[model samples]
Target: MPETAVADTATGVPLKELAARHGLASSGRLLGPVEYARQLWGYRHFITAHAKAKTVSTLGTTNLGTLWQVLTPAINALVYYIIFGVIIGTGANTTNFVPYLCIGVFVFGFTQATVSQGVNSITGNLGLIRALHFPRASLPLSAALVEIRNFITAMGVLLIIVLITGEPVNLQWLLILPAMVLQAMFNMGMAMGGARLGSKMRDIKQLIPFIMRFWMYASAVLYPVTRFTDHLHGWKLHLVEANPMLVFVELYRHSLMENVTLAGSPRLLWTEAVIWAVVVCGAGFLYFWRGEKGYGRG
Candidate 1:
């Protein structure tokens, strides 16, 4: 028998053996969580490029392009402020509510868009999933990344709005950074879980918008969470206060606005936010990864 051929390149792996080594797993193989994570890491560049491409392609056909990212949320914040803050008097006791509503709408929309897009990631990319031999998680991760980019752009406008509405820039505002990180993690988890769920039940895509709408209201995006706690008690009050989106909204509001109190204490909210981010992200990733083999099946 011929001696074992050595790989001639610096990586020391031949094109055939290399493929054979990596080809150890078939497409949609059920990888261990750690192995799945490593696989995803190896595809980081693809994830980033795909995410940026998706974000651009989404608005590329339009003249305004990325400006819409900033405008859409601004308009929503204004509409909510007008409808609930003015007509309904939801802003009755809240100070600096223009900025408050702005923060809530922008922050909540971040997670909301992630979940909505996540619900379609795998289904929308069925062609790519079936054709390409990459990690299935990339689709949802890319969607979450798109939302993260959009959120950053939207925040630029949000900060300007906050300043225009007379919220002072203080050390507390620095808290926005950590809160954003946590929320991003939370969004990633939601995206992962939604992708798995949506891929299985295509009808779920249709229902997500309504679910997010309900989530928005429950998050106190348009009104104060106090509305829930002022009368309700027991599990009801806890449920309202414990809503993850509400926690994120309150965190953003606390960091951005002055004289506004959170639904829960700052300490409680921070602790809960961390837990939500870790638990949801970890669970969502594993859940989505576990469904890898099933994503592209007929």
Candidate 2:
């Protein structure tokens, strides 16, 4: 009998009567702040569940699934040690280059895995993307989480190597905690950006491996960044000095092996590294977020 009443076409019931029966106002303000907060909280829970499910599925798919995460990096370190440390003698001059190489390789693996796997992550799961309605960014985030777990396991191996090789432990080792968090954030950002681009272009996926290989060489995983900086002068030296990966590798090496002071006057290189980390990560996240809806369609 009320003027606000409206009939439901399908059920032939009055809309206002139905709302009153259900204890909800049919024409209430659309998604006010309180409702919006509830929606966001639900989204957060869904994302967490999705991420956990993906991680567990990955581990379940293979017999040695998670262990391979640790094994792969350790095996890589051993191979490099044999070739560079024993046979080639490249690491001979540096004190405890074994741990140095191990840490670099271990950390680098995390970055490489996220970048390489993420490039194909969206495209590879195109079927699922079409069938399911979910956050596309979660694919890259899930992949990064898997790599992060692997990195943690590899780090444990690195600590054992450090102790076995008789490297001194100090408060500086705590610095690695922040360093790892920064690196993981940076890698996730890159993965998200790359995944979006790779999904559309497809050609971008092909180029990722070559890009990663070049990055590996540039990052000084096998040797020191000083090798490049010492030889080149002025702007040439500055270019190599500006590499962000080198900064991360150097920070890890300095903190874990050298136990050097992390705080001091910020050098130009350090300042550049900080800037790149922020810029790449911030811009990449925005770039990926903008393309979120597009991913579900294709």
Candidate 3:
């Protein structure tokens, strides 16, 4: 039997050879890291639009609309204040307990929501993935962006609370900008990692809430970070201080509140913040990239 080669009709060249000559790749093949990044960057507009759409639709059904973005965390902070600050008397020794807890609650809540949404980013968008050829990373990045947009509104409420609680407006408040940037980077990384895991294991989404709850306590959201100093020492103390969420929460406190002292020096906290942001974000991106080809496969 004679085999007939498949050829591009217009060029009259064999299709496989024509594709090779044009530097084409298999549709399902994984792209090189550099190429993948470039492709993802090229889709930035789509990502931003997707994020904005999701952010708007998130609270569209509610009476308050986007106001719930600020209220949700504000209410969480109020509840924690009643339970931990008043009933438990955890805030008795700390100054400016109200703003302190608000910063912790809002910041941790942002990260928790970012990661939780990231976990569903892929599974939630299977239809889009199957129908489109855009970078899959866009889904997770858009998930992070949605939270970032929500967090900005929440921050406005947080600053108002800080002012009402007697924290003076100072130049250090500007530090919140860089602190937020670092936290956003760290969060993007967490979301990418979660997206990858979620694509493979549906159960991971169900577990995220429990994990984030534990992370909230570990992050010192309802209590003073200084408590770690009283109970632990050496590597134990150092390890707890290195928790990325705690580092971010303390960074917010250091910037906004003058009365609160942190578990570590400002220099150490900033260093850890930069390190965690780079390390986690870089590692998570690579981890997710490695699974790129498998993302939409059933």
Top lDDT prediction, candidate number: 3
Clash pairs for candidate 2: none
Tens-digit lDDT string for candidate 1 (230-295): 878999899789889999999999898887878989999999999999999999999998888888
Q: Candidate 2: which stretches are off by over 4 Å?
A: 1-42, 259-273
lDDT of 2 by residue, 20-48 (tens): 78878633233443454354455676656
Q: In order, how many clashes per candidate?
A: 0, 0, 0
TM-score of 3: 0.93
TM-scores of all candidate predictions against the true structure: 0.91, 0.80, 0.93
Off by over 4 Å in 3: 1-23
> Candidate 2, residue 87: CA error in Å?
2.3
Model 1 bad stretches (over 4 Å): 1-29
Residue-level error in angstroms, candidate 2, position 230: 3.1
How well is each residue in 26-96 modelled by candidate 3, as lDDT tens digits?
A: 88788888899999999999999999889778788888898898889999999999999999988888998
